[model samples]
Target: MSDSTDNTTFDSEDLNFDDFQLEDFKYEAPFQPAPEVQRDLSFFKSIPVTVTLEVASKEIALGDLMKAGEGTVIELDKLNGEPLDVKVNGSLMGHAEVVVVNEKYGLRLVDVLDSALTGVGH
Candidate 1:
């Protein structure tokens, strides 16, 4: 007898492909919480509120503005060395000084203006 193995009977039909049914491959989604979950509001009672500053400005005549060439001064509502007005939602809220923090420039709140009215529109 010669010492050789001739096993060539393996083919696609030999495997049981019908065992993998469509229902076995179906995916089941995980549970999710309802959209209308109630949340507690007591934590927001002590939150600090602040006002912002907004500068009221106007545009000068085009002829007057264009005449502003070299060394010509164009005046702004604010004066020199005065802290820039800080406004929130188009209303003056406070004043701040320009400061540098962590290699980046930011505003340092210096003063907060008192509201004109006690309870009504500010």
Candidate 2:
């Protein structure tokens, strides 16, 4: 029909090549610094410290371990009345002993060992 032909022509005209143009394209970008802002290095130097309590031990055979059970008490080198090793960041710093302060258990520094072993304080 002429009406159907007119409808088809109208639809084709909607998608015609004259209706499209590439001049409408756009490019946008804000100016930014090439190098990012640097943080203060001094903040890294003031890291929180922790004192490590280490019970020095030695490895034994599995057969010996099988012989150890409930009543068996594994002994250590620093026994009662001996000063225990006090470490800082996995390094042997000094020695300490168990003490009670205000009804709470704490470590009392007994001696400051020579730093030659640690290669520090020299």
Candidate 3:
């Protein structure tokens, strides 16, 4: 049989922590500024992004669409000479106007999305 005596056991009433000061628990750690990180993101310029020029769109009944042929001209919601929406990776990036360059179709950027709208820098 083990002896029923143990000096390591503690009793809540016997402990007194009120005499210790708060400064006694404090540790002095060295203070230093964190090092800045340097990164090379030049490869971001080489990333490929899909750009699309949206002209106009119209929704018609399935029956009407099936009946229409190449000669059919559907009226769009946008008016003539309106700026086209420029999309990058299926996201609205800016607005542009259509132009003809060397007998090829091209778009001239009229307005670009501000940083506040795209949340670029933020």
Tens-digit lDDT track of model 3 for 55-118: 9888889999999998898899888888999988888889899899999999999999863335
Please, what are the lDDT tens digits per residue for candidate 2 over residues 27-100? 66788768875555555446666787665665788998899989997776666677788987777889888889
Alpha-carbon local distance difference test for all models: 0.70, 0.72, 0.83
Kindly indicate the candidate among 1 and 3 with the higher lDDT: 3
- How many steric overlaps does candidate 1 have? 7
| Model 3 misplacement above 4 A | 1-10, 15-38, 115-122
Models 1 onward score TM values of 0.41, 0.48, 0.63
The lDDT ranking, best first, is 3, 2, 1
The runs of at least 3 residues in candidate 2 whose Cα sits more than 4 Å from the true structure, single-residue gaps closed, are: 1-45, 116-122
Candidate 1 residue pairs that clash: 52-86, 52-87, 52-88, 52-93, 53-86, 53-87, 54-87
**Candidate 1 on 3-119: residue-level lDDT in tens?**
888878888887897776867687878987779856675555456556554433557999998888999977777766788888755667678877789998678878877764222
